[model samples]
Target: MLVRMGKNWEISEEISKLQGKIRNLLKETGWSVKDFADKYFWEELDSDGAYGDEDDKSRHAEKVKKHLSSSSSTAKRLELLKKYVEFIETSRLYRKDVMPLRRETASGMQDAGFKAAMRKLSSELNELLLKKS
Candidate 1:
């Protein structure tokens, strides 16, 4: 499980909790941090024009934060979170492929704090999926 930095929840604890759970699931299933970010996240992220050829294939932690910090439609955010859970579910059956890979754009990404947040979001989405199951 990803260790969240704060005790008190911020921006809806329920969402954070669920996000964390799904994030942990991704890790347990061998998905990297990049897997959480969507293409929109890439457009907002400034990677110093690095890996122009790779594009969405990679991203840094700072870029991830920049993507998360900005205002965006909830639908987009929910879509990414939903993908995370679905990817894990499918991977268990040997379908490890995810369209538009979210691998690390660079080596040595910093700070696990945002990852914790993404995880929380992912978990929250997974919870929603479960409710319907």
Candidate 2:
């Protein structure tokens, strides 16, 4: 007897609430979609093997060994740390790409507050990530 429950409205409501929270957080934190996209760039790169070294199994094994031996934490934590560092670097690159627009907007509106807010947001995010590392 396969008795499947009907669609769960409660789950949908929870997801909607989460989406709203994420939107608000992004707005308050000044985190842009481009930054999030860059954080995920490595996933795309891994799938596409854009890096020529992906084909070199020996090099990959050595790199994996280095990561595994670098810390006393569990292997999962070490891998997470590596990914977090990569994500931060990628986000910095994405932020740089939008620097011109940021400058232009600040200058046009004479909004030092907006610029300062952005600086604070970037510093806070970096600090949080570094502490995690």
Candidate 3:
């Protein structure tokens, strides 16, 4: 009877391990889904052109919601996650893949200051161009 109990305990331990793996896989699947949607919405879609109006934006949101609802199962999520990984591996972004802003500059200012200065200079140049026109 003790030997049989030991075997049962071992089985339960193995089942627990498998359940943990499934849980982690589900979490990873969720992250991948969000990442894919983020890239699709921000990088792939032309937001300013196609989703300019409120109606267009709502329509696109509905489409996204519908698609996500349809792919709610774990198996579907895994399949989509695999495709997302494949797509990311194949896509060629023009810019080098590097962290945009790592930390503050030596002067204790963020890169936003540099960006703001450049924007100010651009606006001044645009004003001059308008005057010349």
Winner by TM-score: 1
Model 2, range 49-95, lDDT digits (tens) per residue?
A: 66535345445544434443343334454444445444544454433
Taken over the whole model, the C-alpha lDDT of each candidate is: 0.48, 0.46, 0.46
Residue range 1-133, candidate 3, lDDT tens digits:
4554564455444444443443354354443444445555554465456655556545655554454444233544444445444444333321113212122224545487786776677668655544542
Count of clashes, each model = 13, 0, 0
User: What is the alpha-carbon lDDT of model 3 when measured against the actual structure?
Assistant: 0.46
- Candidate 2 residue runs with Cα over 4 Å from true position: 1-7, 41-131
* RMSD values, in order shown: 19.7, 13.8, 14.0
Which stretches of model 1 miss by more than 4 angstroms? 1-14, 35-52, 59-73, 92-133
- Once all C-alphas are superposed, what RMSD does model 1 give against the true structure? 19.7
Range of the 10 consecutive residues with the lowest summed lDDT in candidate 1: 92-101
Q: Supply candidate 1's per-residue lDDT for 120.
A: 73
Model 3 poorest ten-residue lDDT run: 94-103
